[model samples]
Target chain A: MSRKFNFCAGPAALPEAVLKQARDEMLDWQGKGLSVMEMSHRSDEFVSIANKAEADLRDLLKIPANYKVLFMQGGASSQFAMVPLNLGGKGGTANYINTGIWGKKAIQEAERYMPVHLAGSSAEVNGLSRVPRQFEIQTSTDAAYLHYTSNETIGGLEFDYLPTSDVPLVCDMSSDILSVPTDINQFGLIYAGAQKNIGPAGLTLVIVRDDLLDQAKAEIPTMFSYKVCAENASMYNTPPTFALYLSGLVFDWLKNDVGGLEKMADINQRKAAKLYAAIDANDFYSNPVALENRSIMNVPFRLADASLDKLFLAKADDAGLLNLAGHRSVGGMRASIYNAVPEAAVDALIEFMNDFAKTRG
Target chain B: MSRKFNFCAGPAALPEAVLKQARDEMLDWQGKGLSVMEMSHRSDEFVSIANKAEADLRDLLKIPANYKVLFMQGGASSQFAMVPLNLGGKGGTANYINTGIWGKKAIQEAERYMPVHLAGSSAEVNGLSRVPRQFEIQTSTDAAYLHYTSNETIGGLEFDYLPTSDVPLVCDMSSDILSVPTDINQFGLIYAGAQKNIGPAGLTLVIVRDDLLDQAKAEIPTMFSYKVCAENASMYNTPPTFALYLSGLVFDWLKNDVGGLEKMADINQRKAAKLYAAIDANDFYSNPVALENRSIMNVPFRLADASLDKLFLAKADDAGLLNLAGHRSVGGMRASIYNAVPEAAVDALIEFMNDFAKTRG
Candidate 1:
């Protein structure tokens, strides 16, 4: 009857404070007397909302001044094609590290417009449970850019460190962008769908270095053009105004309530540790990902007997741990603990897992 | 202060009851314990919401059974490129009528992928104040489709009836859909950005006849392909879930409170007539659009003395007739009386206009 510990991968959990704030302002945002969705995107009030969201995001990530923050639509899947169309011109070669589903998907889209070279792959590891070390694969010298997915939502494998490479680093940090801090200057470009840690579905955050704007292919669709969006401040057309406004509220919450990315990261680390420890504490549960590469944002594990998965998920749902069923691609259990999934939620999940293993072992 | 009479063109106004419903349910939609934005687009809850939205939309318009309603993104501008890419094929010709800004935009984007024939244009009618009558334009039988904008928001020009032609009709109804009744079988495809009469910005509603799905070119990006979106049930990617949900609420509001499209159209007609009569009451105020082609949704008018425009807009804003400043390209005043702008708002605007004209004269 009350709120549940929602573990849906995405659109995943959102901060309760943010949701409450949004609810309070749903009809009249900032005393404007109209819902934020009704306000024109070009109006001063909505403009302030959009500007603040981008500013707070820049501060939270310490994004470099030379980079442009574009609040776009169409999600990260659109970025899969956009990155290739914008960065890798026709006949150009782009190197992609095939570590998991997200990476493979990016590679597949890129190959449609350009030749993609496999810079590295961890597929040899069972179930793609690890990332290939830096020295394990050769990087192409003339790559348009080196692309990699930082955290694979389904595979529960994450890269602990930036891949060492000479080419420009393009990262699909869809699942782990704000959960951790990174040197923004190191990335040529980074993109993530807003459903994970940003705000909601439909909006995508694209941060691209200034110099990379000129590399876009001439014939690409205007909406998918990063350079054009950067030039026009992402208002080339009517944007997802409400989604952008909500994300701004989230950025504000992360700053005033949670402090900043460093504090949020500490909280995330602790939450992931509690859940992973519960799994490793007994032989009754197992997570196939290598210890170093296990995702802190998404903790996927399985009962010793696959037959118990249905029972595990059904009971978890009854206990208010909703959407715990793993992806159909990797059927077991995946408890996605994004920034909004409070540490208490993870503790509740761990407690439930422990009790279940004890009762059914 | 209570809610203002917001007259913004695209992200215009929403029904008060719909906004109130959204506010009341923002935090716990149907007792789900989370904001709609946090629910996965693929979740059964969201899927139901999406399905019901399309169904209600179909019911309102009496969409032919051969049409597939797709909830998409990128707005109408994206559809500009998608139209040519999907229907006209490479180097093929498509007939486009140049009415005003929106038409020119669609033509520009279409020309990138196909040759566009200008069927007829009102540009010669001083400031594009009219639409070329059906007899004035010649339709191309060899063309893939004939494209036109049902209403030009900025220009305040609207087609009084369907364009007579054998070619399949494709219309950009971004500014005026659901405000009136339409014969769905007359068009092969119709697309509208949801910011106007539907819900909010970002989400685009596409109604495409099922038989046209196979014409999409293979080279277009996945998100732009209507065929792919139709096949995936518009879950081709995480949609603008919040916008879609809000639009569904709007549809429900229309069905239960406003009755149906015919009733809504009657109210809209009365509101437009009241405002137009006020403009024509004296020589001091004048509407630029031809009477027969004037849009019921957007009315653009100019003062007899252009010098009074600024004071007029300022006074109107102070009186809470917001966004009355006409588009820059067509400097004057615009009052977009969308479905959500109740008759009271129109009366307020008309009363204000008459008083202003009398005082200035």
Candidate 2:
């Protein structure tokens, strides 16, 4: 079967090699006589799989020894509530930096559990073109923790620099985790829905510092408590076994095949640079986000002739570049070039865009 | 590659046909040039897959038009909190019937949200050998709802009859949901974790009556709200798209390959009966649960001599009968013959058990 360059945001494209390996092992995992999906979560076979996935991820991220990496379900949306429920019990208001749709949603969900203070925001800037600078952010006097979206998936806005906070730093890195190396010790908790840079939907990757685990509200649901999940090694219940297994394959691909996050970041920068260069060179296309804040993972652009938008997407699909349409809330074009997306895929997209601009500009 | 019998309780065996189909389509689903895992949840392709799976499940269970089916994440453990958070907002004590481990866990989670009254309990019966009869279940004076585990995976106990109440009746049918046909009209809501009888570990299936959707507590997390989920058609956020796709294939297999639940139920009864008869005839093996209460899907047994337990498990593994060891909490042998576990697998297991008894008795 022919593979296409898929650019859909969240539940996005997986690495072709990982999918091939998964396919080969679907019926009988390592001659275990059963699919990974069929194994008991408590079984030695599955526990090893779970541990290896976490270990490989830790190695890739160079995560500190004291942090617990939890393989959970319910996506990053669940973490919006979980973050506040787990961290907001310290009798202080939580601070949030509103940058885009995802950041706003996280604030709205957190408001249900604790008092939320908007310490920093991009709303003052037209169209959320950039993020609030680190110096501009103001942590609340009684801030339990400071939370922000590392990269806004839909808006294609990203923080070029990390924001500092006196309270522990928490981030919703749903779209950008593992795309670059980071100092895990700088954050209290960081979570990403696996659908984007990691593996598939259903599996959420949560990395939280050991010290922050015990601060959960007493009234929080047991399942919502990060400490419980950490204590159980993320098997407080049956985790998405197949999803975890597939993600483990992805972690392996990242480490061995792509040569870790440094190499991945280099490739990502080059890929995004080429695409952005193509956009800037053409009068037919224009990107809205400021140069400094442009996300390396997601690039959103508009055709100069709005009438040609439908034709552009149609031609791109015909050229085997699928899911180029932007999110419904923001109607334009967004190419989410996650770690799985190869530079060749970006090359093909650029070639197609150039041809489309030449023929239809 | 040779396939063997796998009897994992949850995250259990799936139909061989379903696995083969999944393997074949892992890279390119329906010539769509992308894996089901790679597709956007909001795309037409994945949406159709989700819709068809829900439709097929509704058809299999004969679910009425008044119910909304939700494909959620975080398993039944998450549901333990969600059930109370969603149903306990009406300001009445929630009544729970405690029969086995799963039921007790459900009650414990509910107690964190609101006042929970134990309507009926099998603790008095000793070792949870039987379920409380309908007449024994006494709903509270101001009962919000009656909740029970229809099939306890760990204890191998199942409710032979429905528990009736004036308020909404909720059931966690995690293990035995698709094994037998039932009247969906009897319960206000029924939920299942897909790993057992449905598909995989990452997806949770919820069927809630339309009228009960609005009862969620205001303080509940948005991700925990059944009303919001139903309104968004279970896509308030990115769903576990690949898991949902695989489950749809399973539903299709259940409908087309095995016929409807009537035929499946007949086969399931026969499979359980033969295994139970084998256990009864051999003095070496003893099933603890009452005959009527014994679970059709999960058959838990113990060795006459406790020392033989390890040896029995070893031989079972050597003979290609895998995962026969019981839950760690109970510490015996459990053969979870889910709907996907073929009758031939059961026959092989019986032969192995009979031979083991004769040689070592």
Candidate 3:
């Protein structure tokens, strides 16, 4: 069956190869006579699946040995609360760089746990069009850590360069983790909800430096504590076994098909440019994000005539481009061309956008 | 392909119909051109799926209007912390009934939040055989609530009758929730992790009484707050969407195939009785739990000779009676015949047990 070009922001498009692989193995994983979904987490088969997923992910990004890759849940949102609870030690404050809604969410949740230093925020810049420039970043003295969102899925903005910090720099890379290359050593911790670049919605990937594990609060809930997660290798409880198995398939696809994150970023850059170029060709479509900080993973735009937005979406859906409706917070069109979205899909979207503008304009 | 009898404790077996449906719809759900895994949670398609799942569950259980059903994560283990953080009203002690490992875990986590009254515990009765009788319960004058595990997975103990409490009664029905029918109005709250009888791992089902939500502390994390979850209709952030979808399919299976909880419970009862009878009929096998407390979900038993336990499990697995190993905490064997396990599987297990015991004894 022909598949549509799905541009969902999250719980988003997975590689066709990965999806097909998962489907083929759904009833009985490699003749084990049970779906990975039904496999016991403690079973040798699932344990190996979990291990390979982590190892392959580690290899994909050249993650350092000191960083423990954890498969967790509650997504990056939960980490917003967990970071402060785990890292916000006694008599210490954590600095937050608020780039967009995700960053603000982390900062707000952190406030409930510790002294939050809203060191820098893009709100002052208006419309959240761009990330805070290097010189604009401000942090407090003796801050426990600095937290920021690497990619804002909603605002369609992202940091081009990793922010420098004397203290540990933690990143919420939920939307763009494997879409681009990253140096694991630069950040003390990084977390991503496994929906966009990864496989499914239930799994969350956390890469935490070993040194920070000991700083977790004594009273933090066992499930939320990085110390416990690291100690148990994220198997403290029954994990999302099926999702983890699918994620390993995604990693395998990334490694064997796309080569690696460096090549992945190059392909992603090309895909984003194709959509941006089509938008730039006509004033009928307008993007609010700054050219310098626009997200390659999520490209949100607006129709020249607000009334035509529904028509555009309907036409797009009819033409097989899906979930292109932007976040309700940001009205108009949002084409989330995540890693799994082939360049062919973007080409199809670009063609549709040009035709859409011509008809509406 | 014929499926094996998967006896995993959690992340356990799923209904064959549900698995087949998921497999068929893995690539495209209802011709939406995107798998449920890929559909945006906020989209109309996914929302309908989530809403219908809750509605079906409510219909099956007869949950009152005063209850809010929340699809959450971090499993039932996270609920241990959330119960105290949300229901442990400020300065008030909560009564806890310690039945087994799960109950003790809840009590331990609750201790970190508020003073806990060990209202009753079965520790004095060695091997966690039976729950304390009605006369055994003791609650503090100012206790916030009473928490108990409806079924102990490890020890194979289940409460035949719901415990009465003056204060709110919070039950972790993780292993036994949808397997049996219950009057929802009797309990202030009920929660269950999905892996056992619901669907895949990672999704957690939470039934919170509307009034009990207000008791949550101001300082509780937003993700963990019943107020936030209820207010947002379980979409405060991106939930485990695929898990939620699978759970809906499971609810459908329970309704359409199994008829309802009453019939499901009856079937489960028969399956448990058959296995228990097989054990009791021979001197080669023994179950530690009292007959009244024997769990229909998890049937744990020991071999007459402990040395033969490994051989028993090996031969059982060889015969496709898979994952029959007991919890590490409790040795011997545990055949967790959750709702998904058919009567035929239990019959197969009982038949295998008799033949193996005859040969060994």
Best by lDDT: 2
Model 1 segments more than 4 A misplaced:
A124-128, B123-128
lDDT per residue (tens digit) for residues A80-140 in model 2: 9999999977789989999999999999999988999999987445653888888889988
Error of 2 at A168 (Å): 0.5
TM-score of chain B of 2: 0.98
Best by DockQ: 2
TM-score of each: 0.98, 0.99, 0.98
lDDT of 2 by residue, B74-134 (tens): 8999999999899988889989999888999999999988899999987435543888887
DockQ-wise, the better of 1 and 2 is 2
User: Positional deviation of B230 in candidate 3, in angstroms?
Assistant: 0.6
Candidate 2: residue A36 Cα off by (Å): 0.4
Clash counts per candidate, in order, are: 0, 0, 0
Off-target runs (Cα >4 Å) in candidate 2 are A123-128, B123-128
| Reference contacts reproduced by model 2 | 0.86
Count of clashing pairs, candidate 1? 0
Q: What lDDT tens digits, residue by residue, belong to model 1 across residues B306-343?
A: 99989998999889888988887778889999999999
The per-residue C-alpha lDDT of model 2 at residue B245 equals 91
